[model samples]
Target chain A: MTRLDMFIDRMVSQRACLDFAIAETALMGGPVFELGLGNGRTYDHLRDRVTGRPIYVFERAVASNPASTPPEDMTILGDVRETLPQAVGRFGDTASLIHADLGGHNLAKNDEFARLVSPLIAPLLAPGGLMVSSDRMYFDALEQVPLPTGAVEGRCFIYRRPTA
Target chain B: MTRLDMFIDRMVSQRACLDFAIAETALMGGPVFELGLGNGRTYDHLRDRVTGRPIYVFERAVASNPASTPPEDMTILGDVRETLPQAVGRFGDTASLIHADLGGHNLAKNDEFARLVSPLIAPLLAPGGLMVSSDRMYFDALEQVPLPTGAVEGRCFIYRRPTA
Candidate 1:
């Protein structure tokens, strides 16, 4: 089996929702950026869908990880916080999607990170572009606080740039 | 077992994704709209989740079919195409998240219906509210297309309104 198949089998077993989010973003059309490019899971998930558009991933050690790196043509890898400026320079306002699955290590710092990164990604988003993050920052609060019927859990918070 | 229990079981068997979606939306603080209120399945999934906000539903014939009517307090039901004016007036700008599992009939008109209702729901969404729909729409496409690694067909599309 191919590496993609092995990764997919693991994801299915773990029931990762990232694939769903990626597909939804792709259906909306995307040149996505993945923060916390853990094992390059989402990069693989989105590679085919956003064929021509480069999938930029930010992992502090991506360059050193052979298993996670893609063909030179499909992906760009670097540290998101430090390398974002260079990424913006290379792409020049073309990013349409952003995914952050950075593990629990940085969860508490999300608001701070968002403050910095949101502006960078915001300008690059096409008309209906989206940013999807995996961490359920509000899961506990939502359970304690009642919501309207038809409410669900585990939706990655999606931020959309205004379409005008 | 209570009606809710039975409904939850059914959802677990057939619409687990929808159930998860509703829970996640609620946790994220949503005012959700469900377009196809079939036998009140989605409503029941979110019954406990509904707190201060109203859950709006559009069913073609909930009034005629007692089984389809959601519990009195949780849902507002009507025809989407014809009664949107009244529905929007009643719900006002509180319709943040919109979901439709209307099967083939509704799926066929998704693009048109989404265009029509998006404006009304757009204003109601809190900064990160979601709009979701499920159908067999992606089944054939998913079969023909090989998803890149780490991807599986979640078979749902979620759209988020632009937040100002």
Candidate 2:
């Protein structure tokens, strides 16, 4: 088993949802770009299953935290907002899937971030490509909890660039 | 164009997502069920695309709203919470896909709904069968809105029931 498989075996949060996305993307069949690269957990889940296709990950903190990255995958260390331009230029028209799971804190700024990131990411997505990002959303349990900070919830949104 | 294609052209919400699920389910090929069949939009979308496959829909309000249902599909007009058992009794072992978009005022009740719905849906899901549901969760635009009400959000969730 690969490292990602092992990590997945122990993972506890929204595994079903994450796995579904991976399966769907693989079924679609194209180059994939992952944003946020959290501990490379999702990467480990996808690397082996996605064969022959190039998978590029833009991780802002990977350089400062090499331990978080896997030794085998094609992960780059840089801010996605800044590095995406050059990366897309290098890949030409091959990139097709852009997957982001940057957490609720990052998602809080999604609109502003999307403005900067979408233009760069949109161009990189090949015709029929998908851009998926995670956001936190209010669930009842969270609402019931009496927190020091008020609840802020969201969910993932997937946008597809028309193939025609 | 097929009957399903014609039906899809008229749907207003969740059209792309519903189309994707239906196409995926048809391509996967097996018995399928749809829970909370609001307006029967999805049923209409899949009817002709999946020829000869048994497609069941459980809807609490369908009996009252006959216009919502398509003539060719099999539909059970009853609450999913109450009728799932009987539905499962008839077709438990062969079901391969479960499509649900059960949310509006139902957001706060997801855990209860998921729990009750999972068992009935679980047994019916063929090995490797996918259970697809669209969930509503708050995001950036709704961050400032009141907790109980806001724009109805939608997110898709899929679960691949384990064969073993």
| Best model number under lDDT | 2
DockQ of 2: 0.01
TM-score of each: 0.37, 0.37
User: Over 4 Å off in model 2, which ranges?
Assistant: A1-164, B1-14, B27-29, B63-68, B136-154
Candidate 1, residues A40-60, lDDT tens digits: the string is 545655554455556766676
Tens digits of lDDT, candidate 2, B44-89: 5555455657777777776323434644347677777767778767
Mark the 10 consecutive residues where model 1 chain A has the least summed lDDT. Answer: A139-148
Decoy 1 TM-score against native: 0.37
lDDT of 1 by residue, B104-150 (tens): 42444765555565555444445555555553232211122222222
What tens-digit string does per-residue lDDT give for candidate 2 at A1-164?
A: 22222222223222333444455555565678877776555565555455666777788777323423545457677778678888867775556566766543333576566655666766676665555555422221111111111111223354556667
Candidate 2: deviation at residue A63, Å? 55
